[model samples]
Target: MGIQVWFIVLGVGAMTLIVWDGKRRRLKQRALSAAGISHNAHAAGSAPIPDLPFEAMLPPEADTPTATLPVNIECISGGSRIGSATHILGKVIADEPVLIKGRLEGTLIAPNHPVSVTASGHVASYIEGSCVDIDGYMVGTLKANTKATLLSRARLQGVVEAPRLECKAGAWLQIDVAQAASRQSVAMVS
Candidate 1:
């Protein structure tokens, strides 16, 4: 009887410690979030994470083909962005708008939506979208079937072939722009 009682007391103590630890972790997470800090350094990436914002919006789950990070593969309809200071490599196919705020070294295909390279974005590959908005730096081919806009802080060094092109003042564009052929081949197949 005495041994059983000691066992029960030890179990209770362990449970109590677990509960307290859980609470402490929650508080720490809250404090970190409030201070503009993120603790989501779980793994690296090589695929496009759907619906993830570029500013520390870490979804509890993500889907990418890299297999290095635990992410989902379910296609999404909304926009997604690579977070700042993050690095992504591999092909990305999305029907929604995508913003790259970090570094991406692969293809970004948004045939129906736009692909925006924010002021902190660095893309070193091909891009295909309805509209391409460049505010940072991009190297490689940029093909926007509809239009491509270069903001004031844009730095582009590659081939750009879009039906329409617009550039803001102070934008650096060393790429040659040519009129793109009609994109009727990949039109909405409805």
Candidate 2:
């Protein structure tokens, strides 16, 4: 065929491929919708969440002085948050701090930062960070370079490695604790 004819044929083929790809994406989206799965690009980190006032993210004030909040608002002010309604099953590597109030079933690596699991959070993954604070349930290994603090409502079942480990009075723990400078791991069942 002539050069001009070859160019025309190539142009037609490109258009056909573009159209086919669009249809394929639409079909995949439809299938996910039918399965009741969210296909939002924000969940995949392709887009940011819509901007909202900071007050909208804050928890309501307690009626009495004895009631404590589930999470520390100050710690989460500029950090990443996994809301209570979210369920994520992938790896997360954050340069900033991470606050989890939902469920996570993979790895979370936040070097030189903090990681917190709130009262309603549930995590089954490996966590590595500068510090870790837990008030929820976790069933995996946690490596904190500085400290690991378990609140009154925390429940952990795995291994914890930190330079300093603090457990509250009512925390439920069934795990092995390894101090950073120690050569032995302590088994604690409570």
Candidate 3:
């Protein structure tokens, strides 16, 4: 056979394979749907609550005056505090609102909750959460899946990923806000 004939045959074979694959995928999807398998199946059931990490579940009293912030000096706050003039570096996971009145330099991860930083807060780490109320200065990636609120006195410079953003009078931001509400909606449904 000539080269052209061979090429035509190969092309036909590839098209056939693609069509077969698509049909197979459709069949699988139908079968799963029939079985009631869905992405949001867990939302309504009272199934055993998945043991989420402490960082994902914010305590109500975390914002109260009597609340004592953890002094791990390793995760959230490191060892830096107000007037320390030191750099806090590492991964920070807080299940409660954390007030930082000092310097920080690392990645902060808080999911399914909101974390607030006071006006004295100066974080140089990536911040991630469902909602983050910032009233200080930050210079890193900031991802608030639901909402990111920047207080009037807040100053931030990082990539933000959220559907809704609230920048008060003097708040600052320097990045795009990626829409993460779909993910949150899925979580809520499941």
Q: Write the per-residue lDDT of candidate 2 for residues 19-114, one digit (tens) a residue.
A: 999999798567656644433312221122223221232334446443334445236667899999997766789999999999876678997999
TM-score of each model, paired residue for residue: 0.54, 0.60, 0.48
Clashing residue pairs in candidate 2, if any?
none
CA deviation > 4 Å runs, candidate 2: 1-75, 181-185
lDDT of each: 0.65, 0.71, 0.56
Question: Worst 10-residue stretch by lDDT in candidate 3?
Answer: 181-190
For candidate 3, lDDT tens digit of each residue in 27-82? 85575466554312221211222233213332233233423232222134332223
Worst 10 residues of 1 by lDDT: 41-50
lDDT of 1 by residue, 1-190 (tens): 6999999999999999999999997986676566443433211221122222233221123243222232221233468878797876656898788888888766788988988887788876578889888877776678898999877666676567787888775566555555544222121100
Q: Whose TM-score is higher: candidate 2's or candidate 3's? A: 2
All-Cα superposition RMSD per candidate? 17.4, 16.8, 18.1
By lDDT, the best candidate is: 2
Superposed model 3: Cα runs more than 4 Å off: 1-86, 180-190
